[model samples]
Target: MPQNKQIHLDNRPTGEAELSNFKLVVGETPALADDQVLVRHHYLSLDPYMRGRMNDSKSYAASQPLGQTFQGGTVGEVVESRHPKFAVGDKVVGFGGWQEYGVVDANQPGVLRKVDTTHVPLSHYLGAVGMPGVTAWYGLVKIIAPKAGETLVVTAASGAVGSAFGALAKARGCRVVGIAGGPDKCKYVTDELGFDACIDYRQHPDVKSMSAALKEACPDGIDGYFENVGGYILDAVLLRLNAFARIALCGMIAGYDGQPLPIQNPTLLLINRVKLEGFIVSEHMEVWPEALKELGTLVATGKLRPRESIAEGIEKAPEAFLGLLKGKNFGKQLVKLV
Candidate 1:
């Protein structure tokens, strides 16, 4: 029997995630069943959506039960396997939670994908060339379908999905304006990601004034809105949407810790003839290969930059997740385990 380090939900967070909310412990690694594999986790992904899982409420997936390890995306190597597709020393990615060793059932949705890491960093399978990249591509091309010369706006522009959205839109000859939290993120969005303009939401407190600034940046009005933070900024964008505008509803990190604040400008959606649609990446796996392939080329050619903020050790997993929620991470937040 092997002892593994795991983080479990000690208590539900009241607002911002606290370090005490997670319990780190050493537990016995379970024996693998027939047709199962024992995976040793290398890296754990800390995504915003995981915040929703911390709460005991109805969602796409159930919240983590108290005393159970929190669920997440992980990249690891197979140590033992009863499955033919996976063998010892196979490098793969899966939903292995925040743990050092995982006994993965081969048939589950979070099963690992074996890959060759010689061409790219293994961490990327959790970021730009993986879920976030695929989510951005699917949301933009499939949902919004922006035309050339149209204006596209994305909030949380420095994040993995936001940067991907901006880069893809710019590639298609659409004008891109990004709304980021601060001056640093604003600079990164406009200078590094090649967006036409960026608005620092923190510097500008008034949404009405920010809306004016956005209108100045986009004189023709926004044709597509890629919403990552849904709150006042969303309400402001609503007032400036062009007729027949499309909104690709992604994660709402602004209200993730609490109940959603009522939008004051939802009527603007009807007044501007805007269409709003929400999406999850699971429904678009068929298009993932194409997105990853194209994103890989861009990354290899240095056209697209994938930024990662990594925390070392499985003990630091909870801190990394909390940082991601507080917008402390510059890009994708990941934890490196044994």
Candidate 2:
């Protein structure tokens, strides 16, 4: 049996997640049974949603089990296969977790999928053309339902989902604005991602100041919103919404560390007659094929040119993930396991 390096959840976090909560382990790879395939992960995705799962609380998804490989998305190549649908050397994407390798039952539908990496990089499958891209599509197309010439704003604009959201919105002829943490990220959102404007939230830390920034950037009033960070950002956006504006509440990352961040004035939703909906993209798998189709085209045709921030090895995943939660990573936060 081959030895495998894995990161496991040693303990659940009480308040904020710390490095002590995780432990790296060296273990022997389990033998594959019938209809199983073994994959050697090349890149591992680190996302904010995983933070919520670390709390061992009642959430939309189950908590990450202690003593198991930390759950994560991976893009890799099959190294061994006992399943007829998969073959050795086939590139694939799956929920392979935080490990150098993973095993999947090929008979289980959607657990594993083969991807073509001719035009797109294999790492992109875990980001822009994968879950994050589909997430942006669902929020903007299904929830916000944007109209051309209208103003649309997305927070975390330099991150995976936000960058993809900008591209999708631009393709639709909507005026897109982004709100990122720092000046560099804000600049990338506008200059590289092609967003109409990007506000630096760090400069305007309060709702009043952020609202003023939005007022100047979005003089026409916001027609739609895609929120990733909650707290003051959401509060500020509510003040700038036009009547009947729609909001796609994708992620409230501000509260992911087990903090209480109540929306200051939820009544604004009523006053503006806004349509705000919170969603998990996985729940709406029906839209994946359609969303991935468009996202693939954007990446293949140079429309969605996303950048990435990759850590060197599996041992560095914890540090990379911690940095990601604090908005330290520029674009997609990935760990290069190979």
Per-residue CA lDDT of model 1 for 26-131, tens digit only, reads: 9898888887999888889999998988888787667888998888889989999988888899999888888999988887754678867877678888887788
Off by over 4 Å in 2: none
* lDDT for position 69 in model 1: 85
lDDT of 2 by residue, 94-206 (tens): 99999999989999989999999999999999999999999999999999998899999999999999999999999999999999989899888988889999999999999
Error of 2 at 135 (Å): 0.3
Model 1: ten consecutive residues of lowest lDDT: 107-116
What is candidate 2's TM-score against the reference?
0.99
Model 2 lDDT, residue 43, Cα: 97
For candidate 2, the per-residue lDDT at 45 reads 96
Candidates' C-alpha lDDT:
0.86, 0.94
